[model samples]
Target: MSKEDTSLRFRQFEADDAPVVYSFCLQLIFKQSCWQLRKKTMLNRGWMISAVTASVLLAIGLSWPVTLITSLLCTYLLIWISHTAYSYYLRHNRYQDLCSTAAFVARWCSGGQDRLFVATLEDGTVIASSGIVHQDIDTCELVRVATEESYQRKGVGRALMKYVLRQSTSFGYKTVVLKTSDVQTEAQRLYETSGFSLSKIYTVGRGIMTVYYYKLNLTDH
Candidate 1:
């Protein structure tokens, strides 16, 4: 469900609409992946160096030795925790975005029968998008589903999902499957609400990450 109440317009995505659609895609893709956040915050090399230097100076400038030492230890501990968490976040998001985009292109754009759709705002901004690709003779894979952060929970995602599911059924697919990460709890909830059942949950890129597979039988719909 989207957080916005405004109704959105639905349309087919155009490769030629590069100025808006493609540009938005790039920003949203990287932003949602934390690429931009990492670049601007302590997760970045430059900011990281500055933050560490500032922390060390602050600790050293403290009047009390015990306080200074404890502050230094805390600062290092905080940096380590932040770095580790950001590393995990970037790892999962980057891997998923790259793989999802590749699969979407191969399975959806490569085939004339495959479908891609985008949601636009009343002001003509493309804010949400999704695409589906053929996985096998009877299975279709849902990929590249994304809704702008501000527009989430309002209906952009729900509308896109509903359209894709209906299209998949009409296109002769027996089952529709998609991958969602443990971090995407809201997305998983939506999928479950839409009748998708958890088929499997698998760990990837060390035990710190988990990916869920959800499948919906179109024939039952």
Candidate 2:
């Protein structure tokens, strides 16, 4: 752990931590979703079309004010479209099902073989958390690896990951697998650095979302 994280402590998840954990997870999901939507919107072909149209208007000797107004209108339209699409997706997507309720989240890590570890400050504020659930006799699945935005890059997440992996090894698991979205670049980096290899890439939501699957062989570690 880095010096910044020296005051942090790790422990098993407790019932009272459900609310905080759920809220944090939900916020992270929303933040990621919004970022992906914004990126896609900016990269969308609609922007090129708008730019071409504006250039054509200018080439045809249209007034600068007219071209400027047209461009601004197009930009506003794109923003509106992006916001509307994001709202609709949030309402209908399975992301909500993952953390639909604090109770559900609590029960997810309540299984006998499931382990959820939380890293907290001296005041008990959870800054990071991760979980592992048995997948089979020889494998386990990692879930909910997240760190508060403000506390990232301070070794909190890496420390929590180490603890989770150690606990998985202690449980006699031979392998650990995890899934993360392609947009979660930081998480992918962390997993790769922690010895996880990319096992697969698949899309869901009719190709709207891309997910990466990773696995680490505990025996090798």
Candidate 3:
């Protein structure tokens, strides 16, 4: 082909690539939009709590110095309570189906044979999810399987767990480990159903943690 014709063809190819680049840009923008919306929702929930706390502190500021200090302290305490309540409400509202403390631990034990698994939801809503990496007594692994809370009880977590286990087997890991707080009894039950068993009990901060360890036989992998 003539040099000019060849250069023209290359230019056409580059021009045709525009749509792919544009689509990627659009995808990135939508993802960012989702994150911003979630943040705004969280901030709105926090606003009322912050306003009430500020008002209480302002009211106390009118009193004598000692009383004012006491009032401010009380206001801060109230603010803290409000923040906690708001967070609980958000989680409860957002993730109703995620198994409770015990279930998560059980799943961990059942799948704890892999050295690593990536855990997370398909979408980017909940960050504190299965894709998290945990270091058991001997192995370090990723928890790549997780289901959205809204889809729990419908076999979402189970499916994700199974997928992760398979992936772990393919990845050539021998075992995986996980822990769930005993407070989550429902989660504990779920884990049992998923073939996980309780392995040990430990403590973190003020909460008693249940550790479930699961080993995948690589021969079957």
Best by lDDT: 2
Ranking by lDDT: 2, 1, 3
lDDT minimum window of 10 residues, candidate 1: 35-44
Clash number for every model? 9, 0, 30
Tens digits of per-residue lDDT, candidate 2, 104-197, equal 4655555678778899998989888898878999999998787877887778888889888989999999999998876788888999998999
- lDDT accuracy of residue 197 in candidate 3: 55
Quote each prediction's TM-score. 0.63, 0.75, 0.38
lDDT of 1 by residue, 1-221 (tens): 45344466776666543344444455454455344333333333444555555667666674555555665455556555664576556536753333344533443344476677788877777887877877887998887677766777777788778877887887889999998776567778889998999999998544334789999999897
What lDDT score belongs to each candidate, Candidate 1 first?
0.66, 0.78, 0.41
Candidate with the larger lDDT of 2 and 3: 2
Ranking by TM-score: 2, 1, 3
Which window of 10 residues has the lowest lDDT sum in candidate 3? Answer: 4-13
Candidate 1 segments whose C-alpha is farther than 4 A from its true place:
1-7, 18-111
lDDT of 2: 0.78
- Residue 113 displacement (Å), model 3: 15
Residue 4, candidate 3: how far off, in angstroms?
58
Question: What's the CA error at residue 134 for candidate 1, in Å?
Answer: 1.0
